[model samples]
Target: MTVRELLTEMKDTSEVIIDLAYASLMYNSSTMAEKVRGLEDDMDDLKFATRYKVLLSSRTREDARQLSGILEVASAADRISDAASDIVSLLRFPPEKRPFITEMLSEADEKIRMIKISSDSSMVGNTIGRLQIEASTGCKIIAIKNRRGWTYDPEDEMKLRANDVIIVRGTDDGADLLVEYAAGRKEWEFEEIVPDDVIEDEAEEDLQNEEELSEEIRGEGDEE
Candidate 1:
């Protein structure tokens, strides 16, 4: 497979490993722990494959420079898998001393969700960075699962394909927007969601302006 495909698989795999690890801690299940450990082996294999591909693909200095980005992104995926292993290590701690990491994640304003890319998705050929999903919808892609495998936090050059499953973190609204957009059901548009405070401020300003306009009309009528 191509380098992008390998990276894509690596990224998706890493996300699964981390999430499985997280779930293990959540339920305190040895079964999930075993799954995480098994996935780590897959992650290791992908990492090596990615590294070999990068080296094989590069020729010139410029080529190496471009390839470096792939290595960095792959390394990042490996680090996440390693981190999952570290998190699983927490099981060794006494139940009383275990960290509530998943609890804290649940409290965040945004949540992670998986979205499937439609066959006709406009995002199919676009790289994650090029699609500008995060900037457009305020949703950040954390992982993607394609035919080759799962990849964690794909790089800028990781071109998307049809039927890819992407994991993203964002508010509910943002996640919905991304899901629709990726499915080609909606086009990209910036819809700013004003905060309650901003909405209140705008309403107050409008009321003041309306009052001033009314007074101005009354004054004009008197002058007339």
Candidate 2:
């Protein structure tokens, strides 16, 4: 099959997985078990298609390797989903039996805290460095969402403008502390700043090198 056809099939399979997840959330254990089985089947089909594409493509070995790695990740996700479904099924006994299960799920969800912040303050600088220094409580900046772009790396150095959303990952207490600080109720100290352009240039250079390597492999294949 062509690349476009493979990608379309993958999208459809992803939709089925999402639907199964939603059904599990709303239905009982018996019903969700069946849906989870169906999702596992769809995931297997996607894994087969991904592997087929990588095996058939001949332009770049690096591209094939990357696609193979993606298939591996998909397989792992499918396994984790199936295991979770099994655990959920065991909690269908009685009201008293479900307390432990409920507690476990709640604890798992509470560990990963997500906090949203706005960069429209006057004391904050325009880049991530200032935010990192200002929010100095061992909290890490995981993602940045803006009107112009969305980044998921620590290397993001774009100027934070008004209405920009910054997603920070930390503990529950740390996230709460950040929210309090952002609301002007708490005091914070500042530190040195770094230019955004320097980080952007490094990222650009890395991308350029990867592209050049791919092009070189394509040219060698053409010469043969």
Candidate 3:
């Protein structure tokens, strides 16, 4: 990959790894902690690749001066990944000792939660767009893990299945409501939703039709 691509990957990896690390703490899941560690390794590899590319491309004083900034940014992203790794280290301690941490997270304005979809859930066999998940429950899904693997910032068309695990971020109330749907404790109920892109397209079409009608009326008046 090019240096620019490597840096971009590093930045994205750093952000997502940090979120997942905190989520591991919130859910007390060793599985999530392991995922963080795997990403930390990827971050290390990205840092090395970025440094190598930057150094190989620098052939003069001017080149070095211009490329130094890239190295600095890469180092900063590396530090962020390191910090995320440290956060997951809290998992090594006993769960009883971490109640205070969970308490603090609960009091925050927004929280991260992991929900497992049950077989009997009404959410089964539905796409995220069809269910209008965020619109209906106010929670945004950040990632999903299933038999296929982990998907970050999952698309609206991604379908839900039984035993799928989703990570969501939102207010506590929203998370609670979504949890009920995932656990099959409450049925999902909401009015049908039209996607924002579809609404925008329809509005643009209407505007174009009005303009065409105005042009036709002006042409008739000129002929008369």
Candidate 3's C-alpha runs over 4 A off are 118-123, 126-158, 173-224
For candidate 3, give the lDDT of residue 112.
86
Candidate 1 TM-score, C-alpha based: 0.48
Q: What's the lDDT for residue 40 in model 2?
A: 63
Residue range 33-125, candidate 2, lDDT tens digits: 455566566666766776676676746878767776766665665565556456546535664655654454335523223344445343244
Could you tell me how far off, in angstroms, the CA of residue 56 lies in candidate 1 after the best superposition? 1.5
Clashes of 3: 0
- Candidate of highest lDDT: 3
The number of clashing residue pairs in each candidate reads 9, 0, 0
Model 3, span 1-224: residue lDDT tens: 99989989889888878878888888888877888899899889999999999999999999999899999999999999999999999998887988987887778787888899999899999999989999888887878998998876688999999999999988889999999999999999956667999999999999999999999999896787
Runs in model 1 with CA error above 4 Å?
A: 99-224
Residues 1-224 of candidate 1: C-alpha lDDT, one tens digit per residue: 78889899888888667766765666565665776777788778888888898888799999999999999999899899899988888888765676566566567676666789997777877787777777888877766779987665568789889899887777888988788888789865534666999999999999999999999999896787
Q: lDDT per prediction?
A: 0.78, 0.55, 0.89
**Model 2 RMSD vs true structure:** 11.6
Task: Name the lDDT value of residue 72 in candidate 2.
Answer: 65
Order the numbered candidates by lDDT, best leading.
Answer: 3, 1, 2
